[model samples]
Target: MYENTVPFKIHSDYTPTGDQPQAIEGLIEGLNAGMRGQTLLGVTGSGKTFTMANIIEKTQRPTLVIAPNKTLAAQLAAEFKAFFPENAVEFFVSYYDYYQPEAYIASTDTYIEKDCDINDEIDRMRHSATSALLERRDVIVVASVSCIYGLGDPSDYKDLMINLRQGMICSRDAVIRKLIDLQYVRNDFEITRGAFRVKGDTLDIFPPSSEELLTRVTFFGDEIEKITEVHYISGKVMWNRNYAVIFPASHYATTKEKLDRALVTIEEELEERLAELREQGKLIEAYRLEQKTRYDLEMLSETGFVKGIENYSRHLTRRKPGEPPYTLMDFMPDDYLLMIDESHVTVPQIGAMYN
Candidate 1:
């Protein structure tokens, strides 16, 4: 675990007024006394966020603030960033602007395929949040209920991260291969996020977490020679770095070994499902399931992926049936504080999600 040396500092012009001071003091006192939960009931005009900021500054802990929706999450994130200008304030929410979930309607005999359009900018912010949590200490993430949804295992994500340093003995081809394993695409003509281009001994990579800055790694034979940051549009070298860390492009990163094992398990499940349907005298259902499962299996075998891959996530993660999927919470430090904004609505919604 990386220890954060910098303490959380609030950069605010206005001091806590009205009931804010008491609320902040009570929250801090409760936290210091090892209280499990505390509530701050305030009217709409009250400066709840400011009080929370004061408590955060006093506690000096990493924080995760959950909002009921994307709008509120974005608002909270903006406010936190303003409050703690020196700290890392990240926004995390579903990247999709619109989503149509995969569903099977037996009565209507209809199957809806999954469809979604990802917001590239939001995806970058999501990556920024995860990376900050792993690499820094003075971090605050404001997220929607999407935080409860599945994400790649943090351990696997950390394992796939590639750290490069100047003067390291490593092959250019090897580094490119590792990037490919982490789901990065190679595009020499078009430079974009999650893409890399090789120009002779130099590899320019645009990480998913960044929008404007691109990393340039120059290799000397089989050894790393230099690393620098370059502006994406201007192509100007901004600064040189001795080391850089590259995280995976996608959240659902998996190893080839895990994919192979998951394929076998998927096949076994398909067989059992087909058998059960046939025994129940539903031959049509059995045929439908068999064809669908086999098509998905073939796609998985050939391309190492399939549409709606999350359906087989249990197998990919090697989790038991009915076990909860790993979420963003798994990426947080052990002693991090969780603040649920608008808890009156957010708390019940979270309970409904589980039920």
Candidate 2:
């Protein structure tokens, strides 16, 4: 069906008796006009997601739903899942059962280091969400502000993904390189998520973001012989698969070349800002900036990461200041349709959602 002319099918037994009809009509009209952003000023219990689903069906475009909290995200995910049983409905949120972010109380001079335990279920859902988005076009991801947070760039993910076939020329070194690029560490001594170990011709991979499903790669003279999934805890083979792809381990898996280029730009900015500070006689701020940037650069050089790393995202992406950061939305194809549930809330949320 042509997307614009596709009918919005409301599956509910109860019809839009009151104001919902007007709200749905307006949203559909705006979407037909190719509006990039819109909102729905809906009240509580107003079937907001239902209306959004109807709009999505009308357009037949992939959609993303952002919720303010995890509970709301879960609710939205469940609802979308029910509404689109045949389509991909996903959830993306923080993969933490508990988290106390690293912080330092300057006034109290107390440091609160990082503390948290991973939530395996949420981690699985996140992996499922990304996999669904990449594999299918009819996906709807309900997420929290976490969607705006940092993650492995989708391009690296696409690159690192391992493509296997029944009979194809494959190199073990090449496969390992892709894994390492995806942030998996070569650990012959210990096996863990984001780490891989080799035994003769067999390889085992613990995908970073996956809670279950460890992949075992069997090689036949540099050609992929077989691929299987195993239980991470039991080390028991759960299923044998003919072919599959493992995504990158982290959200920031860029090449060293890109990192070096980004650093050069950062240095240029440092020089410019330092010159400005000197001209203004802001010696204190200048010294502070120099010390802070130097420390950050040192950290990046040693570990390829540093605290407050996102402050340098602009340099890495080569985007100008005030430009938008990449989000899940950027990963979607152009033919996808976006349906905003609450015009009053979703519109403002899109602009204000960024850090």
- Top candidate, metric lDDT: 1
Q: Could you give candidate 1's per-residue lDDT for residues 1-355 as a string of tens digits?
A: 4543478999989999887887888888899899989999998868999888888888888899999999999999999999998889999998998899877777677777789898999999999999889988889999998899888788878888999999999999999999988888899998999999999999999999997999999999999999999998899999999989999887777788987998999999888888899999878778777878889889777756677777788888889889999899999999999999999999998899867
Backbone clashes under 3 angstroms, per model: 0, 6
Q: Candidate 2: where is the Cα deviation over 4 Å? A: 1-48, 54-58, 94-124, 149-153, 188-191, 274-303, 349-355
Top-TM-score candidate index? 1
lDDT of 2: 0.72
lDDT of each: 0.89, 0.72
Work out the TM-score per prediction: 0.93, 0.75
Off by over 4 Å in 1: 1-5, 104-111, 299-303
Model 2: clashing residue pairs?
39-343, 40-342, 40-343, 61-337, 151-251, 152-251
Window of ten residues with lowest summed lDDT in model 2: 1-10
lDDT of 1: 0.89
- Model 2 lDDT per residue over 1-355, tens place: 1121223343566566577778878988987797876767666888877777877877777777877677878888888877777677878888878777765554554556567797767776777777666766677888876677655556655665767654557877788877766667888776777788888887888876566778888889978888888886787999888776677666565667777888888999999999999899877667767877888888777666666666787776667878777776666667776544444564576568564
State the number of backbone clashes in model 1: 0
Question: Can you give the lDDT of residue 261 in candidate 1?
Answer: 92
